[model samples]
Each structure stands twice: as C-alpha cells, then as structure tokens.
Target: MIGKTFSHYKILEKLGEGGMGVVYLAEDSKLERKVAIKFLPRHFATHSDEWERFKIEAKAAAALNHPNIATIHAIEEVNDEIFIVMEYIDGQELKEKISKGPITIEESIKIAIQITEGLNAAHEKDIVHRDIKSSNIMITEKGKVKIMDFGLAKIRGGVQLTKEQSALGTAAYMSPEQARGEPTDHGADIWAFG
Candidate 1:
C-alpha cells in the first residue's frame, strides 16, 4: 500500500505489524504533517468480533489526551477499509532498545516514571490497558516515552468484547489475573507494570 493515498493521508511505508493491525507511516495532505495509520488486517475485517475490538481500541485511545500516550488523530473508513490515524512517533520500540543491552539505572527510572504517568492518566479515565509490554512502548529520539496500542484495553462500563475464558494480552506480560482469564481492574495494570 506504499505510495497509495487513503483520503488525505498518503501511505509512505510500512512501520510494523502487530496482532491487532498493521501500522504505516503516512503523510497527511490536509494537515501537512506525518501520521501513523493502523489498518485492521483484511482477514479480521470480515469478522464482527475483531471489527468490534478494533473499534473499541480506537474509542478507548481517542478518549485520552496525554503526552506520554500516542495521540489518536482520527478513525476513518474508506471503501470498507477501516484505519486509525495517529500521531507519527519517530522512535524505536522499548523492546528493541532492551534487546541491545541493559539501560542505565537513571534512564530506566526516567522511562518508568513516564510510563507510570501515562498509565495514571489512562486509569483516571477508567481505561485498563491489558497489554503493557515493551513492544507496546516507544522511546522517541528525544527520550520521550509514549505508550502505544490499546487493542486489549478494557474501558469501564464499556461493551464486553472478549469471549469468556479467553486471555487477551501478550502472555509474557500479562498479569496473573489476565493470564487466567479472570476479571481485571486497574490493579492488573499495576501487576504488569511491576
């Protein structure tokens, strides 16, 4: 989809793909700025459950306005293709950095602080980010920590999407309650954070 235009955003290149969707770097013609667009995989697009989960992700993230959390610009659909436009973050995943070597204690503290702040904001809004792993955290060139991906987020009082007994987050990072497919609250986030 490189060089293809979707509405006002022109796809520049593929950024990455996750269980939820494929992300692409795009240029917004209207805003004259770069944006990241996430498209639900075609295979999952035809599934109502997956579509609902995708929409929930957009809704959950869009409701938050925090510097440490990647900003959601817009959710759009064109020719039956649904995608979410987000602030283009120029950075590497935390996972990639950790793979290099151990970070300095001071640096780790800073990153942890920023992540906690972001999580606080989400929790204040009653949004529990069930998936909180290194891969979902981005570290910009400026050392800013921005949390990404809310595909498994659970918004309080929101519609139930996942099936019973189905655990939904990265296994390695999931809280015990999450791994067991039990009901979780903000405490679950604390466990994962720890």
Candidate 2:
C-alpha cells in the first residue's frame, strides 16, 4: 500500500523507513493539508501483540495535546495494513539539523524545556515517554521542537516493556535503573532529558 491512496491521503513521497515502519508524505484532501503516514511492517501485520501496540500508540499519542509533541490526527486500516496519520512537519529532524553544529546552550535548554513540558504533561496523565532521544525530536522551521516515536514506550500497566538484558529505551539515553530492568516512573523521563 505504499503507492496506494487510503481515503483522501495521496501518497506523495517516502520520507523514512526503519525497524518500526515506513513513513510517507501524504496529502489530506479534506483539509487541504499535508500529513505524515506511518505504515506498520508487513511481517507484523497479523501479530496480535504488535497490532495491539500499534493501536495503543495511535490512541495514546492522539490523546496528548501539547505544543511540543507531534499531533496524531487519525488511525485507520486500509487493506489490512495499519497506518497512523500525524502532522507533517515541513522542517528538518533534529538529527539532520544537529550535524551543522551543536545548538547554543540557550537553544539546547529551550529544547529541554519544551521536552520537559511535553513529558511532564504526559507523565501527569501517566503516559511515560520511555524513548526520548535526539532523533525522536523534530525541529520545525518555526523553531518549535516536537517529540516523535513513542512506539516503544508503554503505559505502566500495559506491557512488560521488553524481554532480555536490554531495556526498552535506547542504550545511550536510558536511565541506570531502567537499564537495570527496574520499573521507571515519570522522573525517569526527566533524567533522560539531560
């Protein structure tokens, strides 16, 4: 369904592909707006757990209303494939922009503040952001920071999170306790904010 049109979203360009899924730039005909559509992996299509996680991600992310978090617009199944629609930012991802040079400390602090506010909002609602990283942070042309990819993050009572020596979050950013396989709370997100 990469080149296919689901409802009014005409697939325009392929933006990204990763272990989780593929992202495409799509046009929202009804609103005359552009949106990002993430398609789940084909292999995981019938996998109950992955499907549950994907649905959970769509529902959970859609519930978050903050200036610093990406807005989830809709989730629908087309031809047995799950796709999530989100605000299609027209600027560079933080990873792409960061390479030009490090952002100023003040700018960096502002980014942290934005993330903290977003995380705090989620945490206040008991939605912990387990995977907060530079790559997951998007920097729009207007200088706003929007966090992405809570696909791996889970609600407290949702799932076991992971299975093995490794933890849920990226190794470079995981809290010590989280890496040690301990249950993490909202403060764990603050610890990762650094």
Candidate 3:
C-alpha cells in the first residue's frame, strides 16, 4: 500500500504485521503528522466476526486518553478497506529489548511502573486487555512506555465478543483463569503484570 492514498493519509511504509492486522507508517497530509495505520488483513476483512472484533478493538482503545497508551485518532473505511489511524510510536517493542539482553533492575522497574499505570487507566474504564505480553508493549526512544493493541480486550459489562471456553491471549503470559478460558476482569491484567 506504499504510496497509496487512503483518504488524506498517504501510506509511506509497512510497519509490522500480527495476527489481527497489518500496521503501516503513513503521513497524514491533513494534520501534517506521522501516524500509524492498522489494516485488517484482507482475508479477515471478509469475515464478519473478525470485522466486529476489529471494530471493538478500535472502540476500546479510542475511549482511552493516556500517555502510556497509544492514542487512536480515527477508524475509517475507504472502499471497504477498514483501517485505524493512531499515534505513530517511534521505538522498539519491549519484546525486542528483552531479546537483546536482560535490562537492569532499575530500568525494569521503570517499565513495570509505566505498564501498570496504563493498565490502571484501562481497568478504571472497565477495559481488560486480555493480551498483555511483551510484544504488545512499546518502549519509545525517550523511555516512554505505550501499550499497543487492544485486539483481545474485553470491556466489562459490554457485549460478549469471544467464544465461551476459548482462550484469547498469549499462552505464556496469560493468567491461570485466562488460560483456563474462564471469566476475567481487571484481576487478569494484574496477574499478567506479575
């Protein structure tokens, strides 16, 4: 999609891809700012269930306004191509940092605190980010932590999105209850933090 114009945004380069969507770096000509746009994979876009989940992810994240959580600018569909425009985070994923080597205790503590703060904000809004693994966490170049991807988030007392008895998050980081496919709340996030 490089060089293609989706609305007023011109795609510059591909950022990354995951199970849920493919992210791209784009230039928002209207706002004159760099933004990251996540598009539902072509295959998934045709599936109503996946489309609903993608919309939910946008709604869940767009509702938050926190420094430690990536900001959602807008969710748009152009000619049936659905995508979400969000703040472009120029940094590496926490998973990449950890893969290089172990970080100092102090650095670890700082990251943990930021993640906790972000999670706190989400919980306060009754949003449970089911996927809280390292890859889902971005550490900006300036040492700011921003949580990304609320694809599996469950908004408490909201519509039921997932199938019963089916696990939704990363296996290694899931809380016992989450792994068991049981009902969860903010406690699941706290458990992942540990």
Candidate 4:
C-alpha cells in the first residue's frame, strides 16, 4: 500500500492489514491529533455494492456517539481509494488479546456486556452488525470497549443478500439464524452470544 497523505492526514505507520484493506495509524496534521485510517482495497474500490455499504457503515457508525463505539470523524475518497478516519485508540484489538490466550470467564462476561450494550443500541435503530467477533472489538487504553466494522452491517430495508444459501458473516461469531441463512431479528444477536 502507498503511504501518501490523504488530505490533512499524514500516514504515520501501518497498523495492521485486514481482508478488505490496510489500516494505518495516522496523524491529522490540521487538527494535530491521531486517527486510524482504513483504506478500501483496490479490487473492491470499484465495487458499487461495497462502496455503498461502506457509506452505510460510515453513517451507522457516525450515528452512535457513545463511548463504547469507535468514533468516526469522516469518510472520504482520496484519488481512487476510500478511507474512513476514526478516533485513534491506543489499545490492542480484543482478538489480539484473545490470541495471547482466552480471557477469564468474568472478564469475558464483562467484555460481552459492554458489546451487548452497544449492539442493543444499534439494534434499536434497526442496524444489524453482520460481522461481530473478538477481532472487531477494540479495547481502548482506558479500559473502554468499542465496536468496529459496522461495515458489513445491514440496515432495515437495506440491500439483500445473494441467494446461493451462502453465509456472509464471521463463521465463529455468526448466530445460528445467520449461519442457516434464515430470517433474523434482534434475537440473532442473542443467539450469537450462545
């Protein structure tokens, strides 16, 4: 990936790569602050569906200003790349922590509690997080839990999934309803918790 400035943000360091794109821990020169920038991979850059969903993710994520949600500052298109500028959290991804090992039952429950609260808020607005897992949960330095990747989120009356009996969610975290490709509602999240 290129390490060029997007508007006022100066790419500081490559954070980590994901299936969709490369993430960078950047510095917002204008604001003199830090932010995380996620770039849309070139292959998907021209996909209208992904682009549209990215917009929806921006709107959905920006809607919730809660402490448990990653704060989205702006979503922009620089040249041929799409990037989302989010609050730069100085902490490890929950999955990274889990990778070092599993958490205690009590700690796991606490983390789940915070996530459930955020999910409930989004669900109340009819937003479904199609992808939810330990990897997408960000733990801030101050012990705050923030959910990420509302990118795959489905909104009410939103786009339809393809019909090949295909599943479009994180395999491990997917609820049975989602896994089975059945119609689902808020209950799906509860099932995911199981």
Q: What clash pairs does model 1 have? A: none
lDDT of each: 0.92, 0.81, 0.92, 0.78
**To one decimal, what is the Cα RMSD in angstroms of model 3 from the true structure?**
1.2
The prediction achieving the highest TM-score against the true structure is 1
lDDT string for model 2 (54-117, tens) is: 7778877888899888899999888776889999888787878889998899988887788788
Candidates sorted by TM-score, best first: 1, 3, 2, 4
Candidate 3 local Cα displacement, residue 158, angstroms: 0.9
Query: What alpha-carbon RMSD in Å does predicted model 2 have with respect to the real structure?
Result: 1.9
Model 1 lDDT at residue 19? 84
**Model 3 / residue 101 / CA error / Å:** 2.0
Q: Comparing candidate 2 with candidate 4, which one achieves the higher lDDT?
A: 2
- Taking all chains together, the TM-score of candidate 4 against the true structure is 0.87
Residue 28 displacement (Å), model 2: 1.0
Sort by lDDT, top down from the best? 3, 1, 2, 4
Q: Estimate each model's TM-score.
A: 0.97, 0.90, 0.95, 0.87
- Candidate 3 lDDT, tens digit per residue, 96-136? 99999999999999999999999999999999998898998
- At residue 41, what lDDT does model 1 achieve? 91
Q: Which stretches of candidate 2 lie over 4 Å from their true place?
A: 159-166
User: Residues 112-173, candidate 4, lDDT per residue (tens digit)?
Assistant: 88998888888878877777777788887666898886766677666663344767677787
